[model samples]
Target: MADFVDREAIRHCLARLARGEDRRDAGLIRAAWWPDATFDYGVYSGDFAAYLDWVVPGAEAISNTQHVLGQSYIELAGDSAKAETHVISYHRVDMGAGDRDTCIGGRYLDTMARRDGEWRIADRVMLYDWYQDWGAAIDWAEGVMGYPFTAGHFPGRARGDFSATFFAAGQ
Candidate 1:
C-alpha cells in the first residue's frame, strides 16, 4: 500500500538520524535532513547546521546517546509525507570519572519530502513530553564525575573573577 511506502521512507530517515547520532557521525546525521531543516530541542532552537555545529563539538564530551523510536503515524500524499515519531533518548555523559544517565522522551512531528527517490526531512518540530528527574543529590554530572578543581586561581591576585571550578563531577 501507499501508506506502507511512506512509512518506510520516513522510518528510514529517522533511523539514519538515530544511528548517526548514536555513533557520533555528524555527516550521516546531516544527510537525514534537508539543507534547511529547522530543529527545536526545547532550550536550543536552530537549523540543522546550527544543531550540528553545537552537537558535533560535544561528541568527545558526550559518551553515549541512544534513541528509541516508538510507533509512528504517517500520512502520504504523492511525493510528500507527514509523520509523527515518538522517541525516547537515553544519554550518558562522562564527567571524567565515569558515565551517568541523562534521558529524554519526546515526539517529533516531521514533514518529509521525496527528492530523487530519497526521503528527507523538510520541516520538523520536536515536542518534549518529559525528562528525567535530576535532584539535589550531587546533580546529574557531579554524580558521575569525580574531581574537585577550580579555575582562576592567582597566587598574588585578589579573588579573581573565575573560581569555583570543578572537573570530574561526582559528589
Candidate 2:
C-alpha cells in the first residue's frame, strides 16, 4: 500500500472516460469502469453501462460538448483509492427553430480499485453544484456541426420526430 496509488493512472482513467463520452463510443466508455461499477446520478442509479446508455446518446444528439476536468482529490489505501474531479461542461442542443446552449459545473466522486495492475472506477457519484442554462446563446452553435435546427433558414428545419432510442443490445 502506497500513499499515492500512481496518480497518473487515475488521470488516465478520467481521460479515457472523457474521450469515450465525447466520441460516443460505448466500448471505450466501458473500458473506463470496472465490471461491477455502480453509478449514482441525481436521478439515475445502476451499473456504469446503464448510465452510459442513457447519457451518451443524448450527448451525441447535441451539437457541441466539452467536458473539462479541473482540480482533483485522490487518496489511496491498499489496492483501492478515492478520487474527486471538478468539471465544467458546455453543451448545445437543437431547439427546432434555433438552438440552446448550457454550461454546467460539477464534481465527480469516484472509488478506484487496481486489479492486476489496471485501475478502474468501481463507483462514481456526480455532485453538481449548479448549472447556468444560456438558452439559444449561439446563432449557429458557434460551429457547423449539422445542428438539427437552422436548415436553410431560421424557420426551415429537418422534419425528424424525436424519440428515446437506447442501444439495449449493448452494440
Candidate 3:
C-alpha cells in the first residue's frame, strides 16, 4: 500500500542519516533534512545547516562510532508523519593516555513532510534516555586485551578507508 511505501521511505531516510554520521559524510547527512528543517538535540538547538556544521567535525574526530537503531514507531497522515526512533550510539575517543568509550541511548522524535513526492525531516527533537562513559584501554597493535593474536581485517572509519572501497565494489 502507499502507506507502507511511505513508512519504508521514512525509515530509509533515517537509516541514511545514521550512516552519514557513522561514515562522517556531510553530504549524506545534509540530504536527510530539508533546507529549513529544525533540530533540537538537548545540547544544541538549531537549523539543519547549523546541526551539520556542529556534528560533522565532531564525528570525524572520533576514533570510531556506531549508531545502533532499536525500534521505530511512525504515524502517518496524508502528506505528513510523526516518528520516534530509538537509538543507542557508541563512540570511542582516542586520548593520549588511552581510549574512552561513550554510550548514549536516546529517541529521535521527528516530524516529516512529503514535498514533491520526497519525504524528509521537517523537525526533529532528540530525547535522552540514558548515558555512560568509561575508559577503554586497548593495544591496537595487537588487538584487544585477550584477543592478542586476532587480525584486524576490517578497515577504518575514515572517508577513503578500505570499507568504503569494499562497499563501493559490492554496490
Cα RMSD (Å) between model 1 and the true structure?
12.4
* Residue-level lDDT tens digits of model 2 in 5-46: 478888889988876766566777888899789999787889
| lDDT by residue (tens digit), candidate 3, 81-138 | 9999999998887665567878899999999999999889999999999998866734
For model 3 the local lDDT of residue 123 reads: 99
Which number leads on TM-score?
Answer: 3
What residue pairs are clashing in model 1? 142-169, 142-170, 145-168, 145-169, 145-170, 146-168
- Whole-model lDDT, model 1: 0.73
Which order, best to worst by lDDT?
Answer: 3, 2, 1
List, in order, the clash count of every candidate structure.
6, 1, 0
Which regions of candidate 2 are displaced past 4 Å? 1-5, 59-61, 95-97, 137-171
lDDT head-to-head 1 vs 2, winner = 2
The clash number for model 3 is 0
lDDT of 3: 0.83
* Candidate topping lDDT: 3
TM-score of each: 0.70, 0.74, 0.87
Error of 3 at 34 (Å): 0.8
Q: For model 3, name the residue pairs that clash.
A: none
Task: Write down the lDDT of every candidate, Cα atoms only.
Answer: 0.73, 0.75, 0.83
